[model samples]
Target: MMQFHDAAKTNRSSGKVARPRLLAAATWAGTVLVLSACGGGGGGDAAPAASAQVPVTLGTAGPGDAQNHLPLAVGHSWQFEGTITEGANSSPTSTTVTIPSTRDVGGATALVLRESVVAGGQTTVIEEALVKDANGVAVLAAADDVLSKALVPYWELRFPLTAGAPFVQLDKTGLDFGEDLDGDGRNELVSLYSSVQVVGVESVTVPFGTFPTAVHVRRVLELTVRRSSDGLAFDATETGDAWFAPSVGWVQRKSELVGMGEKLSSLERLTAYTPGSLGSAGASQGATSTTGSTLATEPAWRRVLRASASAR
Candidate 1:
């Protein structure tokens, strides 16, 4: 189970709230949001040994190519079951991700993905607009149940996954914290930066099944919180690993967050998946359709942090 720390007692200087509430909330939100999209096992679980490796062939055809490891199509959904642990207490969790429709974002067609996560008896829903191209999959925008505004887009995955090569996923500053912590009547500023690298290929087993050609990707996120009132700042970091199977999306994921004298760890595995159909005609039609507003112009990380705060 994820734990929320008491903001009042976290960092107090002269009886003033040095570290705002959003500091912990943003850290937790970033950790969960970053780790929730992909797949992998628990941090303590290891992949199969070399002797268990299996030979398999993957498709390389267009957007739905198995090599991309993410097949985006409307109506596709994935269900995951897992456990969240903080110290000695643990709680069961479940997540459901679905692609319900398509929209036009940044002159490209993007699929709308809705993810519902139930943890600690609370449900949080996240909606992301994603685009899959030859370059890989990227998020065009994001929104959650708590925030009325949508977040700006960022790269979720890059093409040509290779080990030892790390790419910057997001590096932006002056992001909104979406709350007026410290009773300052003004929202704080936040800086979010992250990088991702493909570790290697491994065979992973979960409730769904055993996948021999799962691509393992590791991501490291660093968040810096700065108070708009007086320039007070603090730092937090989260490390996560995700496994993607050929033609199937994410199979498992593990994440750990540490900061502000708090640590949280979680592991999730694919339990069931239903693939959607996006025939050649449908794909072409999606490209020509211009339905929704471009999502890149909105505030990006602010909504994510706010959503997590509400979850607690």
Candidate 2:
């Protein structure tokens, strides 16, 4: 993720830039929400919402199902081109996601997806560890050059995709990004609450090709940043919609961030895809036992935040 200082330097000259705190809050919110790639499903005790019609079961053709919306095979890669617009300024950006290998995450074999993003002449790379089972895909850990952290296992996509059935993606508090958001020379603690739902299935066209059966998923995120010393807080909301093609993976995505007198939007479309040879055996390995496993209840970032508060 881009640092808060980088963002400040990028938009400092603009008269329409938001307040210092709001700018940092919005930037951090976008980094966390938009950077995480696609998929949606229910987790833990959360139940799927009722559907008016029969729910569509995706990738149900047994092991190595060719119709799986998200293929976790090594060597699979996706390229995207997009633009980010804030105020009247817009910049071109590109992203590439690839599954370089698989590693054990919490005793489960998980695909290591490396996502490289280039925007405004800066490149940022993030590595995510994920596992997929019959239920859906879950993210276990994520890291970058600056920080590495394990996440509370959460479903990125749940099976039997149904319209209007939103599932909780993440509802965690006390996230400290280690950036001085309020300019008090200390980072603030933030909370993230998000949910995802399959809005509909539609034909979506992009540079890669026209996907006749694209599952449109919508994710809504709320980020709250609080300063401990002054008890000041700010809230930001982000809504993202992604289109995933069966057997092809994510095809398009659009997201918008709204906060304290600022709005930032981005749109990305698939430009290329490279399929991997590894089949179901690679994807399902060590994934079975990880289903519903709840070893870590709190994220490492939250723990750090709690410790920081106590020390102060």
Candidate 3:
């Protein structure tokens, strides 16, 4: 929630010096350091081997297609709850959201959410019962911060694929997005614009069932009117092991984020997921089948940032 203030710390405002230090102590961890150790060489790491692009298709997608349900039209609400973890600390969080199924003026959807964060016997709150649109051509509302602001331009683009799209995007402006971990014909979207990376896919065995996960890195930004200079860019990655449920759709997603540097911030295992209440409510559910899903493998990206730029 804190921004990296190179100019602020050097200036004479009220509490600017301690601001950066305080933020570092609370939000900084070993995320960037770990990324550098593994893949942060020369802007980004090497791409996977070359492969063909999966053709986009559409059909009867079930609840498991939640990830692909882009342009989330009007009159839909999803409830979520999870936890955030750092070194020696873990806290619970909850969110209730409503969004338009169609794209608004900017190709974004309108979103309203109520969120609560709890830590150390204290809780912070945020409530938004208003409409917020996106900034893309479709006006599809994507994810945003607590203030209901768009994070990146591509985040505005929604891929309505029956299965995941197999592709990689590398640009110096943001992230080098790429993934095809499962070889199931679908590739994951890894974006660097917000410093969020999809590292790998994970299979988690839980009490109910086993889920195939997409690992992601999410960095919280500092909010400011100046889009270029605002928002804290701390490292936060989550491994989302998402499972397709019969009646309810995708459920039981587990996530985690690790920070870097002296700030010592990190997010442990936070399980945020859609519940089975959809079936219990007697809503006519779709059949469980992999008919419209993709299952092709993508080629490994072997180029550096320059050649990979076209994927952006």
lDDT of candidates 1 onward, in order: 0.55, 0.55, 0.27
Please estimate how well model 2 matches the true structure, expressed as its whole-model Cα lDDT.
Answer: 0.55
RMSD of each: 12.3, 11.4, 16.6
Sorting all predicted structures by TM-score, with the top scorer first, yields 1, 2, 3
Candidate number that wins on TM-score, 1 or 2: 1
Residue pairs with backbone overlap in model 1 = 1-84, 39-243, 39-252, 39-253, 40-252, 40-253, 152-300
Clashes counted in candidate 1 amount to: 7
The sequence of per-residue lDDT tens digits that candidate 1 reaches over residues 1-312 is 102223343221112232333322221112211211011111112221121111111223434333647767886788999987776789999988777777776565678776777889987666667766656666665553222232245557667766777766655444455565445566655544566778999999999999999988887665545544455555455677888887787889877655545556788899998877662211223433336442221222343333333312
The true-versus-predicted C-alpha distance at residue 202 of model 1, in Å, is 0.8
What is the per-residue lDDT of model 2 for residues 211-279, given as tens digits with 9 covering 90 to 100? 998988777654444554554444455677888888788899877754445557778899998887565
Candidate 1 segments whose C-alpha is farther than 4 A from its true place:
1-66, 144-151, 279-312
Error of 3 at 188 (Å): 30
Weakest 10 consecutive residues of candidate 2 by summed lDDT: 34-43
